[model samples]
Target: MSSQSRKKWTGYAITSAIIISLMIITIGIYSFEEENLKNIITKNQVEIQEIITKSISKNISSELELITFELALLAESGQLQDDLGTKESNQLISQTFDRLNSISPTAQILALDKDFKVLSQASKIHNSFVGATVKGLPDLIDSEENKTKSESKILSINTSLFDEPEIAITFPIVNKETNISNGLLLVTLPSSEFFKRHGNIYDVESQFLMVMDENNVLLIHPNMENVGKNFFDDEIQHDISYNSALNEYITHVLEGNLSTVIVTLEDNIGERINSAIPVTVNGKNEFVFGVVTPTQSINQEIDEIIFLTKIQTVFLLMSTIAVLLVFMLKRSQSFKKEKLTVIGQLSSNIAHDIRNPLGTIKNAGVIIEKENNSQNKIISREINRINLSVRRISHQIEEVLNYVRTTPMILKQHSISQTIQEAVDTLDVPPDIKINIPNNDVSIRIDHEKMLIVFVNIVLNAIQSIGKNEGNVTISIRETFSNVTIEFENSGPNIPAKDLKHIFDTLFTTKLEGTGLGLSSCKNIIEQHKGTIHVVTNPVMFSIKLPNEHSNTE
Candidate 1:
């Protein structure tokens, strides 16, 4: 392939590679950021769930101990030695019950007979419990001595008067004088009451509090209907157990172990993190208190961080691309300018070396043609052709030298009409080619010597393009407020559109004898004078615009 074609394809490949590389880098960054954000959010959620679980369990445990403290104090005070089923004893016990009930209305204080039958009860829900039997109680009298060391023993009880599961504490009652057991005192309270009170006391929102018995039966929940339900026996919605891995994790929770796990649920609640903690009853790990809350709250701050990170990433990428583009563009221009400088230096050296030798050769050819006699007619004719060839080479070398010349412009106010006429006088004009210039004088800022070179090249090119045919070269000057435009239009055969586009490119030409630098040199000269030159091919014309001398506007 040609050098030009190779350069074009190489540029295309480099551009494509840069674009693909940028895309890959952007996608890789996005994926890495997304995964990192997810990991951070998941870790934060686990920590929050564990913290909430511990806080809730500690609060509930302390509250339950307060009730235990009250009961223990009463039992150790020696105030319950009266006979059973007596009116006076009932009145005395009723007064104590009223005092305890005033402190915590949710609690029901009762006196029980030896047969585990309730004798007198003071409660908010049940009006009377004169002779009701309590079910789901262990035979505490059998191991009375072993359990009696402590005033209160925790147990679960279900009675006809209760709505859901209840936590019952049993203590043996003794006479202060004889030290003998007379009856048992029990304090029963709904497990739901503790959960509800916890919600009101604390400011935890969107959290579901639950308490379950050792048998895996749910004793308390935010939802009232869920109370007294067995998690293992009842059907649950969106249970994580469908997945074996999740079920294994849940197994730890059911075994009364402190565990935090993520679970999905229906009803717009979406995903949640569950934290369960074990509570001891009857000196055994027999209850689990859990807090269930949505994961959104845990990740709310993380979401904002991720959003800002993505925006910053995009902004940084765009800024980097813009900076890279600007750097590349400036570098390309610098490289081109450096190349042109080197070519100019080299051309000046070569032109100086070749011009002297060519001048000597031309003189020799001229002497041979002038001194040859009629007998050496063939020799003289050949010498004439040699001189012509030498002249052609000199002209070609001169064109190259002109193309590389980098001279600073010497600005002066000059008459446009006079400059055009002087350029025309220097050109080898044919009589058949009619040339016309405006008589009016228009002043413009220009380098007069360089302007002469520009007009001469354009006029010569026009004449040569017309060949041996009759053509008119008309010069029309159009002056605007800020610019003076001179157009050289010729009636020559039009140049091809494809060729016109590159008419001023270095080393580009359509003529066989052309050095391809004539028009290019003209363009350089015009641009040095802070002017512009362009061409149109319909009738083969060149237009030049220079800044008006009297105009201050740019």
Candidate 2:
């Protein structure tokens, strides 16, 4: 082989070896990071589901509690007695019924005597009420709990007085002196009313919610026909033995503890994820709320995690390889060479711009010196301020031209206030733009010249962001026990969301004529001093935090 061919092959072999090593290292890293990513995604998805479940339970429980309270209050009013159905009794009952009628138009109220017979009612039975009866009225008496039963006061899924199913809330009117019951009052609103009220609480993913009463009978279902049926028997069914995994999961929940469960339908509707939580009605845990959704809801989170992991893995792998390849290809001509080339060009251009301003300053100075020689020299103060602004512009230009990845620093104890004033004295600010500086100053160990650059760049950016608008730029210092933060806030348009993250990135700028090195240089300077710089949008702000040793100089 020719000498050139041999050398080329040698280079190729070295590159292959390096690539193999990187691939092995990256595979190990990818395995670790992928697992971490899955855990994070799954944790976030469960948190969101828990929040939705809590909201559904709270909404349904609140509505039931309110209805029960209203029913108990009107029942204890001491007007409708057990023996008579008088005009005075009907009128008193109808007034309260009429008020609640606005919410449930078909709601009915009935007063039953001790014999469980309807004594008086403002229902649709009319005056033929001598011997009226209901289909499911006996269950509301709850005779098992003696005279102190509270299950009778809960919202029960019953359909006694109406043609269809209704939500019944019954309260007993007991004689307080005897500690015994006289009669009871029952009020039932339509099941559709409960469904209509709590169903639309969220237009989000918690759509498939099953509501059941204290007896485990389904109160509200998407299929209204399924209401008033046993939830464990009809809605949930395990294909195998009672000792199966799914059955065990269900038993765990029946044992009054929350557990995650997966159920597969025998009808091939596919697997579903279920989360069940108890609902509180009238200050008691008397109902069940279950959220059932398709398995794709969980798979979707997995898919997203996979997509994000792939993106991160590819980015890390490509960046590592690309840096190596670019270095090899440009060994004779490097990135630093190109950077210096740009810096040299900037220096020449900025130096030329500085000449005109220097000439103006020199002329102003000569006028003062010559006036002083006349022995009656009256030097204008305006000339001095203009000279100071011109000098500041020159100093900032040098900072931009000398910009590299890092700048050497000399740390000394100095007041942040002194550095800020010096930085602002260099800028030719517009009259319409107001600048406010804090009176309380804090000192820190920082490089004075480099720190001045950070402050100057921040203030100049704020002024430019305001443009011709009348805006205020406020600067303040907040000191903690170990660190002091200097903040710059401006009443300008908020930074766009898309560009906020890349604000300090090298060569990233929104301005048409910007070199994009001002903030980037500031970031480097702050970092070199072992400090951090951060920004927040919506009334743009920049905060620079530096280590402090309680250095306060009044």
Candidate 3:
């Protein structure tokens, strides 16, 4: 491979490596930052949900306490101490329970006599608890009879028709004068109304509110189908392992702990961020309140951060590559300038030294030819040969100097036909060779002196390629809308395909006596005039295109 091609591939490899490294670094940074951002967002979300849950729990506890206080006051006023399960006593308790339900919508309220048999029960939905004895009372009844305080309790009932669980708050009905217990008031608040009313209090719609009893049973859920169900039930959770883990977490929350975790579910709700907080009444754990949110919602802010970071990384990568390209180009220009300066100095020194010796040799040959005696034609012919050799050497030296010359263009408008004629006049045409040119006069912009050198070199190259004194050299000038083209065709031997491609390359030649710089110098001069020059093989023709007057100015 050439040095130039090797350098090109090397540059590409380095650029590709740089791009890949930048991408890897950017991705690494994004991954690290994304993890930290998710943690921060999840932590902040948990804290915010905790605050909301605590507030709702506090409000509900206070409201239930107030109701119990009102019921205790009724007992103290002797309204609940009438004949046990009597018509008048049932009427009074029923009237008071109806008033309470109208205001707060209690699910069920039962007034039980001293034997724990229900006297009057007021329920929004169920109808069988009015006269039946309450079963869960003995487990929850206070052993200390003098205790005048109301207490809240949770219970799970086996109902054949209803799927709802119950949490009832009980207060003893006592006589104020005797300081004795008379009956008990049990109030069961509906989990649905309780959860629905307070769940929507916060403005966060992405999260769903849930309530669970102390037994890990779901008292309220966003999906009503799961209400009053245990967290470990297969109907509620299909994944056995996940259900076991979730039950463990629920038990932890019911034991009065607060936590957050990620869990998978089967209800089309994939991964979720679950925050469990416990609600308390009378300074004791009553139930657990949980806030469940989808994982995508929790990480939304982090996703946005990653997006912005990626955009910035892309911009930075492009900017860096552009800067590097500009820097490399500037370096290449500096190296080229240094190389050109050395070549110019060397060419000037070599041309100056060789020209003096060549001039002396040519002068000596010419003087010897003049002074030779008439009797010896041999000596005169030898002197003539010496002079010819000197001229060829001088021409080769001049070609070398011209090839190394780096003259800037000094453009002016010149007549194209006139310039061609001038260049043809400078060439030594044999009497046997035919020369042809068009008479049309067209003008174009060019550096006259340089373009003349180009025309002289190309015409001479075509003539020499014929290798005979009897061939034709035809010159034609044609004009186009934007350019003027000059073509030179000679009846010369066809150039080999392999040699034709490199004909205009510096230091390239096919002839034994050729200096090799004539055509290359012609190419350089034509290019300096903001034009192009090329050759064809069949007729050994050269074509030159020069910009017209209007094109040059534009």
Candidate 4:
């Protein structure tokens, strides 16, 4: 009786122990699965959020480009340069700027001299910006060619009439005669209010997009109260802990060491992902784009995944998956390097890599032409073809770089007839061809260097089309109160009707050696000047009609 009772009790004890062990193991498995799941989801969300952030950056850049373009058109339309510093010109320019579709009503649009003294400003708050000295803008006028691409700026944290910080976008006014920047057409808006107007990122769920300065102050935020929120203030307490990683991130931001990154932090809802990228202005980090988004939804997904699985044994999996997990973690880390950095590096590297060999090939062709001076038909023709091929490659390189290097037009007043004559003077015109200069000159505002390029390209094309034949390229200019028309009448054979329609189309060309970019670039330059270009077949004339914009100043 005693042995039987003891055996039954032993059996109950062992079964209870087994049940306890199973429960403990199940809890461990679920906990491990949740960690891994959140990691995977965080990585995916980081990529998507990074893409979203870049889009915001691009939209910012696009906004600047738009405002800059509008200012350029004002000059091209005969409005700004001549009467600068005059109240009427200021009123006209400011009024036009205020009406532009891209900026918010609170934006400040202004014109300033090279000394940073404001000539005029348009604003909803006050007209005080007209006489204020723009304290913090980098000297864009005398900077090297590389720095010219940067047209964006963030004015000092100094408060304005609206009691908000400012972000400025400028288009330089260059004096063509002296090749110096004379003034700038600028548009600025309250930094905090700027992001609210961007349709993509205003109020999306629990996500917050912000701009912070090196002083740890949030210069821009969707909430006006958050605009001055500083990360380092000891008197203020935040819902989220702002120690360790955050302070480190601030250091990285102030150091201007990062382009893009996703910062992980402990949140009330388990965890959150926040990213920040420096807004580079004139080669320095003036502000940062900080994106904060929650990761709590990912935990719910993990719970559902674990609950839905009926039969799952993951005990052996954890032991063997360490290396694979490490690899994945590394791959995720690599994504932090971001898209812009990669693409910019790749394109520049490819250009350099391609051009080095092209130069070698060009040098080799020259050596071949000189070393083997045989006048035999095959050798002579082969050398000629080699030279032509070298030229073609060189032209192709220029075309690609031109696309990469193209910047917004800088408008200045110049004479159309003089520009044409200057272009013709640079060319090695054949003895049989006559380039006739017109007696009448027309003054128009334009980007002189770009116009010079346009004129040179068109005249070169005409000369090449004439080849060895005797021909006339008669230049004519006619001006009216509103517009100026310049024509080039060449004796070359009539261009095919089919080609005439597509003449200005990008990458449209009939020549075996042409890059097809010359005419398209010319067309772009003309359009940028608020002008139009067209070709006629009868005399193969290319005509350009530009707005009669003029400036009467030194």
Candidate 5:
């Protein structure tokens, strides 16, 4: 070989080496940035969740204070004066009960004799105890000194009911004029109302709040179906906290200190987060209000932010590596061809790697379709959906490789309606499922292949959700001068509100057989094409939106 040719070849080899080295470095940086972003987002989310939980606790405490004050004022009113006789005293008692009932939905006023037997009841009727003696009135009830001087003592007592776990505020009605006691005026409030009122003030979702009494009995449940059921009933196990945590909380609050505790409980379904707050009434600590929200709710938003941050970081690192590769290529003369060849090889490998899985999925579907039995029919349908997902994933990989292997290209214009139609056509949906698309064509600038993958994956998801039920899938497309918007909707059981934010996250699928990568990949592809995807789900409907911007034609 000539000296010049040899020199050129040597230069080319060095340049190729440098380009490959840059690519390797860029991939490493992408990985690092992804991890760092995840960490930061996770930390921030933890802090935010803590703030929200503490705010909820403080709000509950404030509301309890208000209730206590109202009860105190009602007890001090002069209507319980002894000189008023039975007629005036009864009127006073009736009027007081009416006011209490109006102010507190859960309030109950009880008039008890010196021995704590039932006398008159106000508010809701309680036939179980209308004439029954109070067998479990606490020692504080009988210890009032004014009972010796008259019939009752004006002593404030905080105790729980024997039949149920309710905290009552009992004060003796003593006439100031006679300086003598009459009967005990008991104002009973259920722990459920305490939590409910607090939840109302915060507008918290029902599932996110719960109240358990000191006995660990579920007095207040967001799901009204569980109300009045004991927390330790057959459905739930209470060993998580037992009674120690509740005791600690009550003791601290009774000493005028605020405390917070977190415990985990295993229910029929799964584990849940339980936050307990001790509520002190009238200088006595007898009840604890708890708020239990699922850990999934706290972690979901964080995961999304982390996922997006990781994607952005990966892109930035890739860009940096691309710049370095270009610099190496431009500096050498003979290495350009070799570098181009290497890029082509990498792109081919990525495509091949993606296509292999897709082929397997397709083969699985073909096999499933030949099966005859009903059970086999169900299995075949699921396998076919899996096949479609694999194909969708391969398409996404191809789009990414295409971008990596070439310079920027002009966006192609296509009919949005037609694109969605093609996507729906590709899905192996059940025979009972129906799809509706508008007749009018809406055009938008997008990478046709990439957009098709996004549309197909999303639509397939909707169809699968419809399953064997007689259900409908609706696709609506709208276009503006700069952007095109498409909405795919379906009828299905509502995705729990708590799980909505996590549906797109990696490894977060609700399906038993799902790998949890399809939606995450879809999100990556949509963002790569400078578009957005969102989901809205309710009991009767589930919808997805894809909005894309038109590239400038200039």
Candidate 6:
């Protein structure tokens, strides 16, 4: 090859290699970031699971304690000490049980004889176990084989009768003077209560939860089919066998150590992520709660993020390439200079058009006010109204003029509190109306005069809405690193829903005498300052946001 051709070929090769290397580096960094993000998400899921577990357990335990306290009070009272056969005693017990059942939907309250024959039951009647002697009592009474004990002596027996997937807590009803145990008061709470209460507290969708006894008997599964089923049985044999995930979960729980694990299960729908936390109940490591969220849900979020990142990266790369090409071409650009000159001429024309008519109206109103005669009272009142209308029109015209006149300029920060006070001072608000300002000073970068117009417009609108009713207007200002937000909230009749969207449109008026320009003018001023303005019709809240900066001294 010729020397020139060889050099060209070499250059092309080098460029291609550089491009490939950069692509590989970018992909590697993205992969690493994605993996790190996944780990962080998993960690958060585990933490949330732990929180849900602890919260649910504490709530249930609190409910149980409250129930026990109430029962203890009833048992100690002289009312129930007379006899179980009496009409009055039966009525009291029935009323008390009904109240308990209403408050705790998952609990079944029972008054049983000393031999554990049920006198009454709170839940629906089932033929399998009602009126039968309690079968699970002996095994739970601190027996050597049971490997579990109760903290409160009153809760010595676990009569969670018939493998019905409920938490059975038995407290002995004692005679006060004799100090002798008479009958057992049993409360059976289903595990569904924990799931329902947890669901109400958090907004996450789809959770599968389970509670098991120390022997791994599945006492409660939020899924009704799993209730009255033992985890060690053939159908659920996989859950109880050693080395299995559920077995490991139970072991950690029974050891009194909290553990959170994420297990993936395949079902008819698809693979799902399950987060589990083990909780100790009544001194037995028998209950485990798990929340299942679909992997598809989290995967959807990841996919959206990836798509956005790719789009942003492509745009950024194109911008960088464009800048490089422009620099290489070495062209002198005067586009901004030409644009400014045209803008300046247009602004001068707009200002002249606005100011001339405004001045004419003001002068005409003033001349009318000066005229005095036998009809002076009527003339003066009409002149005053005309002057007010002229002022409103002039303010709106000035807002447009300012927008046309001001060039791209840096905003000077000023005291927002002072500006708002000045705006309020300009309004003819009724004395019955109350206005509240925040205690702290709010500072923001904005044109002081333009900002004044915004506040005045919002406040005037609020005062007009109040009319004759006792009203309150509250102003709150908050600042952050990037932006400052000011909110004006008022209590009055709510703005009509149909008019809400049109309120900010130019020349949209709700009142007969209004110039229909206040809100529109306010919107223009905010946009010119690179800020945003929004109105919330319900409760009549208006908010404005501006850039944050150090306050200007003057």
Candidate number achieving the greatest TM-score relative to the actual structure:
6
Backbone clashes in model 6, listed as residue pairs: 165-219
Show how many residue pairs clash in every candidate, following the order shown: 0, 0, 0, 0, 2, 1
Q: What tens-digit string does per-residue lDDT give for candidate 6 at 1-554?
A: 99999999999999888777766665665566556655655555555555555555544444455455556645655656655435665567667677666445534566666677776555543333447777656456444344322222223223334435456666666777886766766666655554455444343332355656555666555455666566667766653233377567656666666666554444432444444555443444445555555556656665566545644553336434433443333222224323333333333344344444565677677766666543678887887787888776665555443433323344676899999999998877888899897777876667886788789878888988988888999999998777788999999778888888898886688887675667887888799887899888768899988877632232
Span of 10 residues, lowest total lDDT, candidate 6: 148-157
Q: What is the lDDT of candidate 4?
A: 0.64
Candidate 5 residues 373-398, lDDT tens each?
44776786687677667765665564
Where in model 3 is the C-alpha error above 4 Å?
1-21, 83-103, 121-162, 177-180, 203-207, 221-226, 230-248, 264-267, 299-313, 317-554
**Cα error of candidate 4 at position 271, Å:** 5.3
lDDT of each: 0.67, 0.65, 0.69, 0.64, 0.56, 0.61
Could you list the CA RMSD of all candidates, in the order they appear?
Answer: 45.0, 27.4, 45.3, 16.6, 26.8, 24.9
On TM-score, the stronger of 4 and 5 is 4
lDDT of 4 by residue, 376-414 (tens): 678768877877776656656655444333354777767
Winning model by lDDT: 3
What's each prediction's TM-score? 0.45, 0.47, 0.46, 0.44, 0.42, 0.49
Residue pairs with clashing backbones, model 3: none
lDDT of 1 by residue, 1-554 (tens): 99999999999999888877876776576566556655655665465556555545544554455556555545545345556566765666666566555334456777776667887766667668778886545453343334553356766667676688777767766667777766677887766665555443233442377677766677875556666776666353234235544355556866767887776654455677767878653345646777777767645754564454445544447735543443355346546644554454445444545654675677677667667754597897788678768766766776776675444477887888999999898666889999998876798778887788788888888888888999999999999888898999999998887897899998799999997888999888887777899998787789998878767644
| Rank list by lDDT | 3, 1, 2, 4, 6, 5
By descending TM-score, how would the candidates be arranged?
A: 6, 2, 3, 1, 4, 5
